[model samples]
Target: MRIARWTVTDLIHDGFVIDDRVVEFPDGLTVADVLARGLSATGELYERVRDAAATPLADIRLLAPLVPAAVRDFVAFEEHVEGVSAGVEGKSDVAPEWYEAPTFYFTNPHTILGPDEPVSPPVTERLDFELELAAVIGAAPGVGQANLTAGDAASVIFGYTIMNDWSARDLQGREMKVRLGPAKGKDFGMSLGPWIVTADELAPYLDADGFLAVRAEVYVNDELVGEDLVSNMGWPFPELVAYASRNSCVVPGDVLGSGTVGNGGCLGELWGRNGSLTPPPLQTGDIVRMVVEGVGELVGAVGAHVAAPQLPRARTRTRARRR
Candidate 1:
């Protein structure tokens, strides 16, 4: 089943997106409400609204599925890591440690936006989008395992959604060099939705290798820029989620994004394809659309460039290298 949150008029509602129609929960039910009881509880809710009167898909405006409890985006793709490392640092190899564990970072849940929303990038140029699939964490209260092993990932995963992790390449490149952050560069906004498809709905497509054999694609201004298969990632969602929940907890509404796919999933990778000549980065009015076969699509236009302000520093230049 596909779950969605959208606005019909001045009122916002949570509902099931079934075949070009939205079957809203009779009351003020929300994604959060259903998540609290865990996705295992969705069966009954699905039954409740399965046959209800629905609004036409074109009549309502979709919103971000929910205000997540937290968002953790994991870099599970080796090719993406290697490509980015080489593109930015001129380094061509993945660190030995990177292969041992899945690494991720927390992103701003507050900046979340929905499909068709406008993204105001931090700068007018060098903006990019990452095509990814985000798995929403189910309620952690009881799943028969407290430690949460990779083997138990299926029990805790509720569903998936397509994500466009927007980036200001210049800002990211600068800050990341200091070994501090991708902050300010990545936190501007992230687009998620179309709707969330429950795990059970995707069971049929699970491959023999235990990976979801889904095709991922990114289009900018209706031109295809990137495409890849989700199975290319070395570490699967279960491993990433298990690692995340280790020594901690993952609650309902928590979202974890499968990092950018390989084979030119973003301009950073695409620009580095050839030496000097490259296509332009995202600018105002560029529409970035991401599609994950089972998860659906997310489309957002680059609205406008934000005017950058002065940086706080005691000096303008760093110390010179020794002779």
Candidate 2:
């Protein structure tokens, strides 16, 4: 079943999205309310609202299905790693160690936004977009955080959502060279939702070979520049989640992003590898649309900004090289 959080009549509410209609829950509140109640036992809650038709889709604003207790975005796509690493002009060969295991980072939960929300460009002047397919964790607690088998991984997945991880490319290039994970480059606003499809309901979308066949695409101002299939990833979600949970715990509503796909996933690609070649930079009013097959599209518009009158300047030179 597709679960959604929506706003209607100036009030936010929880609901099940079925056949393009929103069926509101009793005591109607946000989807986060249901998640805060612990999604593990919300079956009856969903049933209680399954047939309560309350609002029209056009009148409600959709929010991320879960207000995650924690959000962990994983670098689980090898092509993205290899291609991004190679595309950085002087850095053509990806290190041998990147293939060893799935790595991830914690992002700011407060910056989370919903579809159709406007994204304020950071001070850096080099904003980028990443199309990622994310999975929400179930409440099933695993034993000692051991390396989970494929089946074990499957059982722990609550649902799936499309994530657009907004990035500041210039800041990312400088920080990532240190070999530590991305920090300030990623903490900006991220857009998720429209609806979260539960694992059982999404089974058919899983390929016969066990891989999920989600496709990610990014369009800047109506021009398509990035496109890649989830099937192309080096590691599957099961392995990534299992590896991530090996020595730690993944709680309910935790989000794991599949990471950026190749060719146009970020502004670095448009910036000619290392800010060498001149490419178009996003200006005020530019629209960026990220779409994931089987999920939904996240559409955002860049807004205007005026430079501060007179600000103290900080040194901006660096020599660590791009990763």
Candidate 3:
């Protein structure tokens, strides 16, 4: 099922998509409510939704499928690390530790945007977009599912959605030199949705290694710039989820991103490979569109840059005598 949160006539609603129509869930119920009920009850819930009223998909405004409780984005693509490292940090080889485990960074949950929304980036000259797939967590069936094994982590994933980890490359490169943050460089904006495709619906595309073997593509101003197969990830979704639960817990609405794909997933990789900015950075009014075969398309626009106010610089420290 394709589940969505949308608004019509200024009223928000939760519904599931059927063909070109949206079947509204009964009042006061939501996708979270359905997911909390567990996967076994999906059939009955679908029947109930089908029996209710539906609206034409064109008549409503789509929203980010859910408000994430937390967002953790992982670097699961080796090619992405290689290319981005060479491009942004001038490194040719990936760090050895990257191969030992799946790695991720937390991003802002409050700035999530949905399809067709405009992303107003901070003052930046090198704006870029990361083409990724995001897994949304649902209620776990048993207690103490923490520190899960890779095989068991699959149970907590409710569905998948398209993700755009919007970035300011220039700002990012400057900060990471201190080896601390991709912080403000990222976290300004992220995009998810159109809707969520329940995990069961994507079963046909799962590869032998458990990776989603779907094609992912990215376009800027309607021109196809990058494309890759989702299965190219160095680690699969379950492992990413499992690693996330290592000594920690992930709850329903927590999101895990599949990092950026390779072979054109982002302009930074292209720049790194070619040694020149052939396809210039994103500009105001430029449109970005991403498509993942089973998950659907997510489209967003770049709005005007919001200028930052002058920041006070830190003063140099003076030597002090031991007390």
Candidate 4:
């Protein structure tokens, strides 16, 4: 039940990975598209696709599991909050309100980059990485189209995927100084996928009491930079989604990121106040790899960007148009 979107022979389709075998789903396949058909259909679809022929996974290029209608990231991890708080001006213990409610930031869905793609650092020089998990919404009544609930959020969730919230520390600091959340500091480059692991298929990894125990780790150029336990999150993923969907609506293929995952998650959050520094920023040849226990890893290389030739400025027109 590890659902994925991939391209082979120059055609893209929804697929599921079943033990070294590649099975194709129907056209325009999406997590919600499968989920809406119910568990019986899900199993049947897997069987139908698997019965075809097994293809080597490496031969196909994996795309983001879902083509999201929208994307948001939540600050739900306690360790991440505490770690970042300690480094901030005067914040310390977790905010009282944070425990009572979920907080999130809307991210540009178009900014999402796929695995093995090169990520160019933005204008700011202090580029950093955040290891996170994204809940990929499957199908849910009303939610994908209108009102949503915590349980609905769970139902809407098709599966999970690893996320990298690439950050610009300097720009982030400058923007947050005005007391607003990140804008330019983020949004430029965020990475997800290799593949999406469906929730039911990943059930074994879920604890006996119905919880996930995935470990998150991030590496830069094969050097371990950060490690954290997903269980350290303050508010659970369901609540994060429910709270985010209260008045607003979430739809199929929407993504909700579990912000940064605790210590070593980000260099600025980890070293900004300690007067220490982290490994060098990624260069054209460097590689970044992020792993989650249940889900697969996302590997990408840094590549050079060619400067586009300057274009002439257009003259501003103030005259009324003639019909």
Ranking by TM-score: 3, 1, 4, 2
lDDT of 3 by residue, 186-224 (tens): 989999998989999998999998999999999998999
Identify the runs in model 3 with alpha carbons over 4 angstroms from their true place: 142-144, 319-323
* TM-scores of all predicted structures: 0.93, 0.85, 0.96, 0.85
lDDT of 3: 0.89
Q: Residue 123 of model 1: what lDDT? A: 66
* Comparison by lDDT, 1 against 4, better one: 1
Q: Model 2 scores what on Cα lDDT?
A: 0.72
Better of 2 and 4 by TM-score: 4
lDDT of each: 0.83, 0.72, 0.89, 0.75
What 10-residue stretch in candidate 3 is worst by lDDT? 137-146
**lDDT (tens digit, per residue) of candidate 4 on 213-309:** 7888888888888888776777667777777777677766778898888877766567643545545555567788998888889987766633335
- Predicted structure 2, TM vs. truth: 0.85
- Highest-scoring model, TM-score: 3
**What is the lDDT for 30 in model 3?**
86
Which scores higher on lDDT, 3 or 4? 3
Superposition TM-score, candidate 4 onto the true structure: 0.85
Off by over 4 Å in 2: 27-45, 87-89, 141-147, 178-181, 270-279, 305-323
Error of 3 at 106 (Å): 0.4
